[model samples]
Target chain A: MTKKIKETSNSETVVKTEEGKTLDQTVSALSSDAALFNREITQFNVEAETKKQRTATIVKNIFVYTFLTLCAIAAFLPFYWMIISSFKTEAEYRESIPTFFPRTFQWKNYSVVLSQTGAGASFGRILLNTLVVGLLSTTLGLIVIIITAYALARINFKGKNFLFALMLATMMIPGEMYTITNYITVSKWQWNDTFTILIVPFLVSVYYIYLLRNNFMQIPNSLYQAAKVDGLSDMGYLIKVMIPLTAPTLVSISLLKFIGTWNSYIWPRLVNIPDWRMISNWVTSGFTDSAGILGGSTSEALNTLKMAAVCMVSLPLFLLFIFCRKYIMHGVSKSGTKG
Target chain B: MPDKKDTLPQNDVNDVAGVEENVSNDAPQQPQAVKPSLAQKTKQAFADLGKKIKGVFVKDQVALIRDAGNTVITAEMLAGPQLSRKEKFSRFLHSQSGWLFVLPAVLLMCIFTFYPIINAFVGSFKQNYQATTGRFDGFGFENFVRVLKGDTGTGGATFLQCLVNTLVFTLVSVPLSTLIALLISVALNSIKPLQKAYQTVLFLPYLTNSLAMGAVFATFFTIIGTKSNPETPGLVNLALQAFGIAPIDWMGIGSPTWELGAISIPWAKYIVVIVYEVWSGLPFKILILFSALQSVNKQYYDAAKIDGASRSTILWKITAPMISPMISYLLITGIMGGMKQYSAIVGLFGEQMGIDYDMGTMVGYIYRYIEDGYTGYAFAGSLMLFAIIMVITAISNRISKKRVTY
Candidate 1:
């Protein structure tokens, strides 16, 4: 019987057909591999449709759509208000009767905020500072994360498990616990007003290391061995094989890191002077008509210019969201770690 | 042989004995078809016993010496109970690349993460600690006392008050937003035509700069006109005016308050905070819960339908429990994130957190102390915040266990 089974190639449950191996288990409406995503996810009331049941489903559908529409509006309202207010004049912004649409559009607010060359309020200089810090930190941090994750994933060494556990344990402690001491340490080194303070301290993020390690692990070890057999060194295998394979995860990490640096407020605010602080820091300073580009008391804080500043800060992230929604959402929902 | 001799006649003994010897010899070499006599079997057992006895009493040199013909394995090749220090070090170097790979991360973490953790604990205990000078008066719990008592000399919002605000906000908003997210995700899951559109729109807030969003939200409810000289009371009040209710000072200094003993609740101001929290926090929870809802097996719904269960019954009894683990995960993380909330308050109410810093959260309190050069108090406050997170996490875990049915 065993010999006959082996000869027939029927010992395994999966049947080899012309198409491919036939599935052993029964496939439900969405249980098939291809259908999991493309098919609608609703597990509806699939009972035989009587007129009453049909009407019930229709009513339920209506309620669901209305609720969703209302939620979407609530979710989109702030963004709309921010954009519209950015175009409004300062006097119009504070109008007791707010205008949904700007009475007169203005590109003047953006130009006014951009022209300020004051100490902390220098828009061009701060943007340059943010870009420099975001780039350097992301690149340096990526290298550190990659190497650490690769070693943890593929390399066999003494104390590897212990080292990983220790790293993960740090995540349990809130960052605020140790950040106060870091302030003293940085200040003691007199690293204030420099980019080193911003880039170096936050370079080693344990969460990213853990995430990349998991991603690296998903690429099978046989590939690593195959690379080695092909006369590739370990570093070469990592660069040519592991890195390419985990490109999606790397893109997600890089994007998040950049967004993190862009939106970072606390560390940059604490350790560096405002002149060297990040983009979010620049936005927090009340954007007034200090230039008097709009008709107002020059020193008075204007919501229009503030909105314009916020618009400028938020645009890049918005663009990133549109282009890379899949990668971003996957990264977020998988780990739920933001920066 | 002696038994045979006794049993057989003297004349026939030699021939019978020869035949018996041949049969025994044949039996020893042959298969189980030829059975062994008892005497022959006894002799073979004695031989094996001798070998076993010899093995116990004396050193078996054969174990040390490997077999030359077949695969060679010796006892000496095995690891002993103890390893030499030199051997350990050499083995460490054998995996040198692995060590080198993690070296940068371990070094930076040692410097910035691990060392600072130790220093915060030390600094928190030191009395009259000065940051610039790196000096301390002595070691005591005075910093903890002053921090808890609101006597750190820099005053606006006390640590206790901040703790209360954080708890109320977290307890109220996290669950409220979670329920709202659950409802939205369920609704989103059951839709077909506008699924992608609704999903894209709802997820727009996920990438928002909270600071910018906060300013926009602040405009929505911020009565632009002064209380004395009344004008249009923002969009929210405008809607309320349609219902014939008067506008209130929601975010201004003149905002109404009801003092419950030491702790005060600014209901109107809180409404703004809670509203923003729900709005800003919805996308992430929806993303998480929606994905979870998608993967829930249709079998459960089918089973519930066969049982004649109502829609709400299936939701509460079947669907909710199916994703209870994800819900609990969301809860723990949401509460923890809420405790560390500083920037959202800063965005809504400026760096001072509110007018006179009345809206300070726990992290805001810690940063305030840190900014004021009261490093000791900052350390103590941060430690307290850490402890609170640990305790709350434990409680949430306990609550989570009750929800995890299977």
Candidate 2:
């Protein structure tokens, strides 16, 4: 405070205002040198305060950056550990003293895991199952959500509000409630080991439908009326105008749905179909150096092999993130902010 | 529709009675005006066929009805029209076109979602229910009783143990992670240097497979070999050794435990779970809270600064309250997601989830019965899980309702 007062006494520029008016002109017009001196003193104090704030801001920034750096490192440590461990030998991985970096990188670990597909159903087949299921379900789910959203948004119908409310209410219930019964339902239909089972049951995501419906509702009613007047059918208007307008939302919803399918574990694991399990289902199963293929005498649940598999699984998601980051982040932020 | 109307006049040249009727329809209303061209007359006549209101071109005043094509359409048609019961029925059916759009979603939800919920409620009550045969001896409280009493006749994870584990994991991890995320968000919000790079690194974990990440975390805490051959005590133990702490078996059988009547708290194991949860959960919470912080009105900060409020005071009084709603939202979702956690535990401790399912969560317990052929118990367990989630949601809703600033 004393230093501030001292600095207030020091600065005396009497800065010019945006109207091209200076304290010198204003006080000279008033014919009071004392008032000019007081105005300059006040200006000095303001500048001094800002100067103090600048130092404080720099200090605060240093603290913030340091905290952020530590947090970023903590956040990234697991991936680093996973990568380094994947390259380390199994023996080295299990050594009494842990190695920060691999003495020798093991590219063979991935080969061994990939080659030994007999135990956990080959990685290739699992990848195919995932891709097929993801694409089909994402496509089918988007269609269901879009049409449902369109009907609810633009079309006049009885019991529409009630239907929408019912869909929204389902989101409140824990997903586990449906899964146990879905198990029974699917089993009763004997729909095991098929892509249909994976794709069909999860086709209707009420949340995505709700999202798309809201997006659809954003289209002007005048536009619909105009389309009617212009001899364009409802379907034509929807295809040419509504879908294109909501393309960003649709893209995000599709990406999220595909990612959901890629990350789904419980249902696939529950079905217990080795031939048709999704990518996440393959994560928990022990990957070993079987057939003595990696020059190992014994087959054990190798951490290195599991790490290699984890890397393979994670790489595609990273690629997806890099490519579709804008859409993904937009979807997430919209959900957060809107809610 | 347009195509039909476009060529209707030329196609039906032989239908002179219909053409005369079309001309006679507008002749009365437009006696003072010259007749419109034939195509315009046909188009007007076609448009006004189903809609029997005033005909077009009365002294060149009536708007030319262009291509309505025998449908009951007009600008004021939205004001509604008086109709016969059959027309009303047709209109109702026309209105029901929206149902076509919602049909697939409704069907899938009924079969997969709604029916299952009802089935889950009903199936839980059927005593000795056989899913295949659809038979039950009686329907009472038998399944619920068995689940609560831990008397499923299977020797896996008991209900009480799983519940305790779940509560401990969720209650500990969710808040811990939320705090860490808050701190990270605030820091990230403040700094302008390398902000995007820092953000990318922080958000890297968000898209990761939790199970895979869980395995990597497990490797950190895992003791690989026993004393005889003495492999690594893992990276975590190595870190602790630098601090003069002895090695501990984190996920192994010798892991420390505090037991009470079939419920045990393995602190070391809990720490590992909590650590992993905090790490994986941070990205999302950071994403949410950081955005919330960014969107806060800057004027409030300026006001507080002018009032000579300290930095921490500004943070607590202005920024925190501004973002409180988002924080509460994060807590509610974080806790909900934490309770349903299954895959991460599986990744960390393998399929059995730590020596015959001791670390089983609520969802894990449901799966235990589902996989073990105790369908009734699984249903009961799932219902109980549902009830718990509902209660938590209600409580969270009430709390957030009181505290939400905007």
Candidate 3:
């Protein structure tokens, strides 16, 4: 079954390229009287077949659309619930029968969350901390990755292939394996609860390096050779030629890395206490802390506040995904297929 | 092409001549190039110190000294004369100076990833490792033995239970999610319009923060009202109740009745995790398979139509095998990712899993050890996980080699 699929898919590409060459032959043969008569008969058969196929298609479409619409709702409902629940007041949220929509919009909940402080930092402060961590880590990581990828891709060096293979092998190891020792190392270095602890350890991502390296490899090596022949230094060539050539990929890597840092929870939870927690850490920890000035210390009150915080935290990422949907999808698809 | 290459070679020759002339012109300003600089002297001192430290471990001082001498000889050749084999070798090394570009990243990886991995392996053998003094009482296989025996000498579920949880989670979720994603992708591909809108909506879960969304999921499954009345059930329960089914405590904290072997399988928690995993994992898998399906030739379907093949036959025979590689890719990655599950569960059920480590995964189990200062056992657990991942990856790789085609 699989082999047949491969052949059919492969033959499709072949047919496209062969179509132009075979067009004249088919047209000329169709012009003959006997061929025309045979073609007319086949055309009638084709019309009938197409009509039958059309009904089948309509039936299929109905089923497909119904299934897809149901799945889409299942996908979208949670997010819709989150947004709507964020606007629900504590009393409404705690009602015996849950309301699909808020009885009355509670704009004050957002302001209350913003005003509340936990882990020695306000919500806005945690957001800023997250932004700073994301920006710094991504920027530093890109700089390191770009240079490494350029060297691996374009430059001839001793043991370059071996180094690349070694890096690829590291990717196979579960990242949890490194967490224990890294925590110890960071603690030994007295880097706990600091941005340095968050940003530094994760600055070198072999996956991003591999992705950018593949992109750099796609650029013609002749360009590097030409630049060298023109007396351009290696660094000069990398910055002038390669970087600009792979800007879209670099942007994709940066944006994805930024989102990764923003969404990071476990590492921040491990190393940073409440004082230095990122926005994600705050969303999980801050709402449950009784010291926060948001509302009364009840599960019902906290649920509303928690939903509001979740909506606030997720809003920026949602907007970013909406705006840069193409790049994000392209990056993921490129990595998935290439791997 | 010949004429263009000929002109280009001439230009290259002129450029080389220009470079040579410039080097010769600048040669007078650097007359003492053969002499080592202060930086070179410091670097050599550091290398000598490194050799001394390494001698304690390596016992091959002669080879180390010989390598050091060879480096000095190469440096001298680069600075002094350009007529011998040494000079040629030195030029080769100079041309391969791109190592300098990758040096920073390599150094960071060595310290943060490679060194820690080795340290973890070493530390796993150490008993009662003292973090403050950076010492251990002794080294043995005791930690690994304890981990395997599910006897951490602590009052909790054994490491075996955690391993089972992880394996069961991965085993169930990976294939289920991949199958759903494949079906969804196929259905989405068959449609003509609103495909993008459907894709955008379906991909929403992927963009969500797992921890936050997990909290939202916890809310979705929260059953309100007393046990008898069950008046205000969560959304999921409400939907189930519409069909006359009773509400379930989805996090499994309230009451778990299902049992598998010695452990009670918290079906509610398992279901919630699997649902979340499938929903979140769908976007990437669907994206991959959909693209693969779209790229399949329409002529195949037409051919099948002429042969009077049913839609199911066409889909199964012609579509599934074509996207087998993508399916395999998602499966392997999904399993690997599922085994490493941690924060999402924590987000759903908090730090303690189901009344005290009942739902603890392998990673969560390791984390609990870490929190309790059982660093040795934690490292041991990590090594076991590493081994499992390697074996699974190898087996899957071999299977894919035979099963998946370009």
Candidate 4:
């Protein structure tokens, strides 16, 4: 099956090359001596203009580089401020005029935030909760997404198009509309303050399913046919052929889902308070509560400690992004292009 | 050769029928065959069921391939014997396999998403929804009226204020961010050196925790000096001071505002929120537009160059039109996202907006009611938000259809 698809494509390319050669030959045959001489003169003119264009290009590039550098600094300076502020002593942080660099690095702020407990949950516990929720939701969501996408893309079943269209329609509605009822539903189920509330409501993502479906559809149907001829079952074809082929897309989806789960604020904050709060909740509420004890009644100390907490929560994701930058960027760009 | 192979399954079907008839005919004559053991009978029944299921699936497989418009079906298989009861059941299962795969997701969506959406719509009309008793006193437009009238008894900005704040935020930030992103993307696309570095740096903000980043931004706006002391302003104020301007209180009681009757627009908070929105929102738009700019045909640029077109003309005419669809897409989605702004504000302003929900957005207003146990009002606010979103989406869809250049 694969061979047949390849052969047809190859043949088309061969036909295109043949047509291009003929066109080139006709263009060359039409040229006369006078035309050739005129072309030479034009080529000389182009060669002369190239030197002038080169200088303009250099000047343009310099301007582009300078502008981009400034923008990049603007984009990155806040993060730099966050990091430097995290390391500043309370007195240094509050010195009427803020210092760009810390006079004395107070690494104790990190230890303070990590050890401090807010509303019966420590910062460490909150971080653990975030990791657990992010991992569990992303893993479970991926399983459902892969199967649904495979069935939609590969199987010939009734009402498949209608089901897909319905799912897509749901994406058009802003998520804020559902939060009120979702909170009510979760509360009624007695699932609030539990990990189940965090994981269950968001387990089925229509966008991820659509993305994986597109990836699945790109797999040649011939592969499925050949797998069938080899006595492979439907599940076997999906696991062995489709999943392995779309590993990059699956990885992209998983990373994106995990990042989303890690960055989630509103739903988790609504359903799970104080005890079950994620790291973000801790960043917001925990720092403010501990400001008196940690900062010693100085606003500067409180601000410094808060920056430390921010840096701690942001570091893991920042590192993840830096390391797996390609996958994240590729996934984002692929979604944009496909849309 | 393919035709000969296609007939083989038909021949096998006939052979199986003949064997079945012979077995049934011999069953009565042979006492042992007729009076088989219970286990033997069960095994025979299972075999027959399996054969029937296989036959149905095989027929479906043939039909599916034929539907691909690649193969020709022989007349014999096309007009074969009517489906038996077992075959019909198997065919039903085969057709429903797609649902089997999608059932988990669909069930979850129905329970968590679809049901809740419907419930929210219904609950919006209820005057007082009791969470404990799981009931409402009666259905009326009281919830909607109270919410719209800003009479939630919270003494905050009316629902109208929240709606106006949300609309203004969306209207101002979406276009501003899109324009900045377009300019940045065009510049980034033009440069050849360190392009990846610039992109990665710009995208870092998109990945940061909003609340934490909001903290950083809050500090950015923090002024160290009071009116009496008149010293040590925040980074933003310091920057303003460089231009010989007075220090502005960005997020405090003295923050700047423009009042017209009951409605007051806090310029300081608006500036802060818009800046945050533009910063956080720029990466995705830049990503989209940059790729679109990259894919703009080089031949067009060459033609424009040959015609001695100015840089601005080439960009507006040749490049802009090519990526107009992406711009339209970003605009619509950006507006939708902006209208749902809640977390970023919470991160910046804390829970109450101001002392009494002064800075509350539509989502934030609904949330405040939810926190106050006014489920009906929350649901009503949600419905209003949904309606506004739908109207905007419809308008955007119409605009895109007319303006987007495919």
Candidate 5:
């Protein structure tokens, strides 16, 4: 049964037979009769029908634009709120209900967060740390995931199917299953306070590998065959052929990894103590901690400080999205194939 | 091919057993047949087992040694080609060129994912205290028990609360996020111009770190607090005061009110969390669903149109059915994820701000146990949370399977 279906789909006979009809001439001959028979069934009235369909099309266009406008507002509102609320004064912010707009700008909040010296962590240092962790982890993750995915997608070896299934199974296992164990591993390695501890633990992601492999598998076999004929080895084929073809997926995956690491607070919080801090600490821990210490009390300025920190953390991604929207969107489409 | 099953037992076995008669007659064992009745067959089977056992016991030591040696050498010889093939493959695999390509990733994942998972498991079972007293007590189920009962002495909040919170969070957010994403995707898929632009914007939040964004949203809400006695600027209060209504204390827990014009719900904080989760979550749903939606052929829509079907009818009959598989995938994964949702809550609540330290979802309770050095309790909490998430995902999968068209 499968063989029969495969042969039918593989052979282009059905499509070719359909295309050989040469229906264009018949359609043109019936064009004059289209108007006379417009109300009745006719073969050549699709174009006329399309023209008639313009009214609904226009309405749909209007509705879409309006809907898009509302969606864009919804998408951008939280970000805008974060930025705007960061500048609001304590008193102006203390209304019975939250204001859509801020009354007074509290620019000093930014300076206050940034200017503190010998503080547990400053906004500047935190930003630097976040960038470092994001870049390093993403770069490393990309390198590992790309190679592993390429091998799984293209190579044949013992237990290949089993391993792939295992990877999928890993996806089913919640991350919390390994959280405590992972914490212990980091501590044992003396990596708790270091950048290695923060970024190194999430090196190879199964989901990324699965996504990239799925994308790589879609690349035409002819390209690899041609490459092989030209003396390109398997690794060479992956580098020269598959990577270029699946660049969009790689970029998207990398962007997500970068964002995940950049915004990662729990792992950093879990692994690192107050004396040792990352940029996340400055924004999250520092902002929340009233005394700006690791395990200090909650701050009265928690709202403003936290908002300022959020704005700073999210700024890079927001800007990246704004500028490289196309590339990112392309990446998203390619990798997010599984709903 | 020659009816071996019928002839073999009748001819071969009987002939082999009667070989001595043929050998004695000097016929060079041409052939012999001895058909056995059912009782005779059973008796013969028992006699053959006894012969096999007796042969083993009566074997000469020298002949036995020779047979054993021959067997080992012959087996090796038989395996020689396969071994060489394996060696050749490994050499190619470990060659300078290919090895470099594979080595980096192998080392990295081993260091990151594998190492950490093993470490976390070990830590969960151990009774370590502040980098010292690192000892394993084999105190089985103690930590697990303590966490479940909330008797680990880490502020009396039980792990059960964490489980409930996580459940509620997942139950509320997963379906809501999926619905919103479906709606947005359907709306976006129908549009031609600026469809890409709209998708990009909506999907942007999915790419941003939720932890960072959660902190931002918390602050935004905090700043909106009421102005009269406001120590913190929160949005809810500002809006309430502007409308001549009392501003809400968003972060704190509120008293339940049944009377009119009284505070009935913790409207401010609940709304913030929900909105934040929705906002952060929508992008991923849109991304996943949009691609799934795109995979659906326009031919279905065309056929529906030809049948004079309305847009709503087409969506119901065609798009929904086509995307049901993707919906199921998203549903299971989303529910699992929602059950384990933590980073955002941690970011929002921090160490000291929101509702004392005791009020996070189950994951928070687990985190609290870990903080207080209740490894057993934390492990138990984690186990409970894991079981709950697994159960929820399984039930959702079953339900979705029933509803799924494909």
Candidate 6:
């Protein structure tokens, strides 16, 4: 290493001394000689680096791939177990060395959940209700929040600071603080056992508004100004320019809102009566199993059925995640970047 | 209750239906042309002046006065219109657009949210039961007093412990989960093709309803089988058995503390609650960190590489500093989120779990007391929890904001 360093230093000094004679003759002579030496050194370095990088890259790849695969498996294990267990017979589940994979798939669990025995809560109706509530709430929430966020972000107004601060302050207060009063208001309005109870009460989200406002604020002022010069109305600018530009953030927030409304358990639980049930009622409120579909209380079939029910509820969202992983990741990352 | 009755829209169903009473009778004869005379107008103005004078002096004159000469006015404009340029602008601003673009949001918010919040604040004061009953007695500071003392008397469990428990859990778990998420996000950020797949997989738990997650945890954690030749067969117990150790009787009726034949599961509820919480929360942090990581310019990494910096050095010296703002944001929000955790506990341990509900979480205890008809105590507990969260969050914000390198 010392010898190599000394040689390189000597060559550097020689090159520096030669720099004063930098006209064509010195360059021509040196170019011919230097090209050969440069090729030799470049080849040597490339060969060495290739060998080293290939080996290290292989090892690194192996390690990263294995670690990442393990994490992915760990993430999916519980869900996979839940799905697999859902199809197992009651006897297979209870055994000391319970089979990890079911010998025979019990397809009836899905049917059992779906069929309205007209006795207890039907999983089908619950699913339909979930869809209704999710879509409705998301739609309403998106409308209110998008307009409000745009107004706050683009429209310079009086009390803007106070309003913005108030919205942020709302986020600090626990949601439960509103629970009793919301319940009272709903009951007073005779909205219990109805879909409006779920949708209207949660019509706006302060966090989403805050996030979208931040996103909207990042759009260039020139875009809006140009739109205005073209005689586009405020609504037109929002629809034509702002919406398209903020689509990624909008999609991300909408996804969050949809998921939140879908996954909401407590308010629905408190207000929803028997007939007016949602899918959450199946897994949470009533377990959605009547008769012997779940194979008596202590049966392995029961655990399996519960797992199946969970899978049924979670599968759609999970599948959506799998397919649109890129979109979701892109959307999520962009949303946070602006923050 | 009487006010509630008054507010409820009454249906005048049959009394007016097809009853052909002349509408003009109720309208009354048009009063013959008696416009306000100047004398009457002067008398009225004098009376208004008198009322204004009284409003300045009388204690109960709030209704008589509109502004009390305290409207939002610019003080610099009081130079009898001989003001400077700045004062004119200031005065112009005072009267212009007080609630212009913000009016719609504030109005909707007031009707939809603020109204309900006011109701909650008012409800926090009085102790009432049976929804329609008007018979509530004000307890002054008694509710707050009881909350502080951890006294429920005839109500239920002490709420003070729950408040402490919530604070402790939030304090511990927020940082813990955030750190875990940060580590995972950083690791995952370096990968190429499988990055999207990994994020989706990890985020699965957060997508599911917390109630379902809690139920699954509760069922799995509950003790299984009978005492003699007892089979402790949950996942944890099975793992213990595989290790040739005795199985823990989780969720047994006895205290899992220092007593013989006792089930001795230390902070079982908190663990269960935290596990479900962390499982559901990791995705949120991962998304946050991943986005922050993406914002960092690749040029920085290239520069560090040119300087012969290692990966770990680059992470510490380059990535961390760049992402400190996001990290701080996460810390503040994470604390706030954890402090308000209610649905997870309620989902798992509410009446359905067949275990004594954990009244140890602030919201859990408040929820329990409310269900048991202790409104006053629940509100007081909620108020205390709110105060604690606010103080902690404020401190966290101050510290994190100050320390944030960005």
Best by DockQ: 2
**Candidate 1 error regions (>4 Å):** A1-49, B1-92
Across residues B1-406, which tens digit of lDDT does each residue of candidate 1 receive? 4343232212233433443454465444666676664334323432433321111111222222122234333222211224679988887687766989999999999989999998888889999999999889989999999988888677688888899888888889999999999999999999899899999999999987877778778877877657766555778877787899888788998888889876788877788888998898899999999999999989989988999899889889987888889889998899988888878888888888887678989998888888888889999998998899999989989999987764
Docking class of predicted structure 6: incorrect
Candidate order by decreasing DockQ: 2, 1, 3, 4, 5, 6
Q: Which of 2 and 5 is the better model by DockQ?
A: 2
Would you list the clashing residue pairs of candidate 1? Answer: none
lDDT of 5 by residue, B202-273 (tens): 866755656677776666555333345555445545556678976555565452213323112234554666
Q: Write the per-residue lDDT of candidate 4 for residues B318-378, one digit (tens) a residue.
A: 7888899999999998888788888788778776675478888989988888777888888
Candidate 2's residue-wise lDDT over B1-406, tens digit each? 5433332332233432344455666566664477556445644555555534333332222223323354433323422454789999998899899888888888889999999999999999999988777889899899999999988888877888898889899999999988888888888887777989999999988787878888888988887778334477888888888999988889899899998866788888999988988888888889889988999888998899789899789878888888998899888988888888888898898888898898899999998788877889989999999898989989999999999886
- The digit string of per-residue lDDT tens for model 1 on A114-212 reads 986643657888989999999999999999999999999999988899999999999989899888988888988988767889999999988889999
- Candidate 6: lDDT over CA atoms? 0.64
Predicted complex 3: CAPRI docking category = acceptable
Write the residue-wise lDDT of candidate 5 on A1-339 in tens digits. Answer: 987545444333333354453334434344424423442554468788788799788887787688778877888877887787678754454444556678777686666556653336655666677778788989988888888888777776555676668567766655665666667666777765577777666887888888888898998888888999999988788888889888878777887777676656667778765444565556655544344442224455445655666677678777877776666666554443211
True-contact fraction per candidate equals: 0.72, 0.86, 0.72, 0.76, 0.49, 0.33
Stretches of candidate 4 above 4 Å error? A1-59, A286-295, A298-301, A334-339, B1-71, B225-227
Chain A only: list TM-scores of all candidates.
0.82, 0.83, 0.80, 0.79, 0.69, 0.75
lDDT of each model, Cα atoms only?
Answer: 0.80, 0.80, 0.76, 0.77, 0.63, 0.64
Clashes of each: 0, 4, 0, 0, 42, 4
Query: How does the DockQ of candidate 5 come out?
Result: 0.26
Q: Kindly report which residue pairs in candidate 6 clash with one another.
A: A90-A301, A126-A279, B256-B263, B256-B264
lDDT of 3 by residue, B1-406 (tens): 3331222111233432332343344344544656533333323433433432111111111111123334432212222342578889888889788888899899999989999888888999998886556789889999999888877788676788788777877898889988888889999988778998998888887677887888888888876566567645788888888899987777655765577775666677788877877777777888788888999888988999889899899888888887888788888877777888887777777667656887789889888887787899999999998888889889989998998865
Native contact fraction of candidate 6? 0.33
Error of 4 at A175 (Å): 1.9
